[model samples]
Target: MTTIPEIARAAGVSTATVDRVLNRRTPVRESTSRRVLDAAFSLGYVTSSDVERLSESEPLTLAFLLPRGTNPYLALVNHRAHAFVERNRRDARVKSYFIDGFDPDELARSIRHFARRADGVIFMAIDHPKVRAATDEIVASGKQAITFISDISTSRRHAYVGIDNFAAGRTAALILGRFNGGREGRVALIAASRIYRAHMEREVGFLGLVEERFPGLSVSATREGHDDRDENYQHTRRLLDKHPDIIGLYNVGGSSDGIGRALRESGRAQDITFVGHGLTRDTRAMLADGTMDAVITQDPDALFEAAVLAATKGTPPVVTAELYLSENMPPE
Candidate 1:
């Protein structure tokens, strides 16, 4: 393995400069940083990531990016995340920046702004190329990148803190298959967008598992609801109108209320069994009302802790997930 000293010598910089660039302690001129990075890359000199303690010396800041979720289920995540940050603030060892929603250009601007301000960033945005590129620039600017919920495409983010989406998809298929008593029927999948890696992988995993395990169940159609209630309503209505045989629906994103409404309006509520994602207030109510069968869930508190740990400590996270049903929930 090529040593930092060797790279420093080759790049015509001191070993201290190489160390500073690697640890992101101080900003070097862009040309010097590039030369050192290129030399390290060429020599395959990967930096060690042993967690260095905070030293009780310098304070830190972490930036967070997440889509604005008005739905009670997801709102809980945001609220709890903010509280968690506050708890960490008493020592003045941590600070936070929250980006409300996702707009490619706005998020990009936010990333650029935070790159200079934060020691680390925890991103929950979609996996768009532009988002990834902006995150990469943040990394290049020396901030540790921690991605939560969805993995971005172009950035070499430091850690991922959420459920293994493929496994979640497989779990969904298993639950749905058992719900149907192994009797296959047409299934409809509605997602927020293809830009979210977790959502896309869940759909892929669901289809893969169903095809491999329960070959009789067929997918009727897939639609992008963009995680909007009105859009979900319209898409659900269209899908039901076009495919009256659809026996199951999986909502892998926000706001299943619209879909529930569409099914009720179509007089097909009893005809279809719905399995959705998350444990939002509305979804929990739907499960209670028997509008939805079950929900695949990740604990919001655990997710927030894991995200913060990964942001500050730069370690891989293990997600603890659960399958929720009406019988399993606490009485309201």
Candidate 2:
């Protein structure tokens, strides 16, 4: 069994500091508190009194408003969130709501509803004025409104728990440009929607990098796939037909499968360099088969854990995007 003293020693802090972090009885430096919590988590440290106190008090209700789709990444997020809630059942209650389609009004309604009931709400925000207003209202109501995956910059969300999307885009551009070997051809950009701040930022970064580093490569006007496989397929087909000279492709959202399918069917899978986001079963297969060259991904578990910590501890840890290739793909 891990004790307070063990955790204090592991964190290189005094036992009193560990106690204060665990009990929340005193204000400890953020760095020290993080160290204590990290040590406790690493050691599986727990106290009988803490469990009893939590079981006696009202559980913190956390609401996760995720996008509804067949997107494997989002499905993984939903699954892991439920698992997290079950693991912390004694301390918190987590409810996940999937918003169908891209209806800002519907998403706003869901946000408003949860704001009234949940102690904290984390959502994949649509960058819209109405959604931003609802998020602002939720924050004003003293509830924690944290945005994940995508964020609404104009909103008053407490914090964003995800990777730096702009940097992810730049990284993708760097890989795609290098793989093409300074080939003078157009690069097609696909995304779910420009209304998603994350996608927009990625597009901005990709274009900026291509302009600065790969002057020989030009980017096509981004096509919105709405995160739908069929939509992405159609868009990709249209792009390939209109611009037969396109040598590279980058998908800033879900639907890597669609993009891969289009390339495979057109017999261009081996010719075009493909880069995308997320490392799911489909993307892993694509990588193995040479349809996708690289994937920019962030850990869903890390993202959810950060959001939960932000809700309970008032500080969300930063997550960085990692580039995955066939050789470096994560184990299933």
Candidate 3:
């Protein structure tokens, strides 16, 4: 007999999507819906017959703690999650919460608050031990905790939903190398911080690929951007002065919006091939203007869905590694 798992595999979707499709609970694309129905027919799978018979189920209250700020990306996450919850409320009764920024104390307080009422909590990965302890407390109190954007303590969260930092890094190196066609020159890297696991992992992957796959390129120096554009710009400016031969650049974190400005002012923009992570509005515009060559992005909807699913459904989502180019994505 074909299970929901089988249907999901056949349909190239998550198991939750399978459940939604079968129950007539959520809208699936026509072509995909047809494929799923056909697969079910072939395998003798009946939609929702068994789900309807399940004895006990609880409507989940899922809370989302995200970076509190005016950033469009973060705002989009909140909007998408709220929309999902609203759409699924009749059946699942899902609820979510948002926290501004990376304040550990505020996050801990929010976790404790949601733990009182929620079945699950989804938090942006803040690597502080206190934050991990708070999540551990939530899990111990019988509520699931899921990590989003970055991975935190494994023992605290139910699952992690984000890109493979190592793979993202390797992608940066690959793009830069191919963009340069493996010509010999120093490459500069700017990142949010060496302590951030996401940025560190990317650097590790990029360095490994550069050493093994593109031996012609040498990583000259790395600067910690601290997620601040001004600092990133200053650091990049210093690096440019110190390493005049730098022909390639990769930013794993804050894109040093100022770095681009400085490079343009110095008339070195055309001399360097730059690749960065994230598809912020500014970065998108930069790509359009030829200031950036490529961007590594984690799907916003996918990331939010993964966080929600991990909390409500206890499922770990598969993170997709995507490289966006100007030609592929016009300025938005």
Give the whole-model CA lDDT for all candidates, comma-separated.
0.76, 0.87, 0.74
What are the TM-scores, per candidate, against the unseen true structure? 0.78, 0.83, 0.73
Q: Which candidate wins on lDDT?
A: 2
Q: For residues 61-101, could you state the per-residue lDDT of candidate 1 as single tens digits? A: 77766666444556667777777767754322344454545
For residues 187-294, what per-residue lDDT tens digits would candidate 2 score against the true structure? 999999888899999999999999999999978899999998999999999999999999999999996898899999999999999999988899999999999999
Candidate 3 lDDT, 198-282, residue by residue in tens: 7788899999999988888889767876666677778888888888888998988754466677677777887799898777787
All candidates in order of lDDT, best leading? 2, 1, 3
Model 2 whole-model lDDT (C-alpha atoms)? 0.87
Cα-based lDDT at residue 279, candidate 1: 84
Best model number under TM-score: 2
What's each prediction's clash count? 1, 0, 3
User: Candidate 2 at residue 53, lDDT?
Assistant: 45
Model 2 Cα shift for residue 50 (angstroms): 12
What are the runs in model 2 whose C-alpha is more than 4 Å off?
1-57
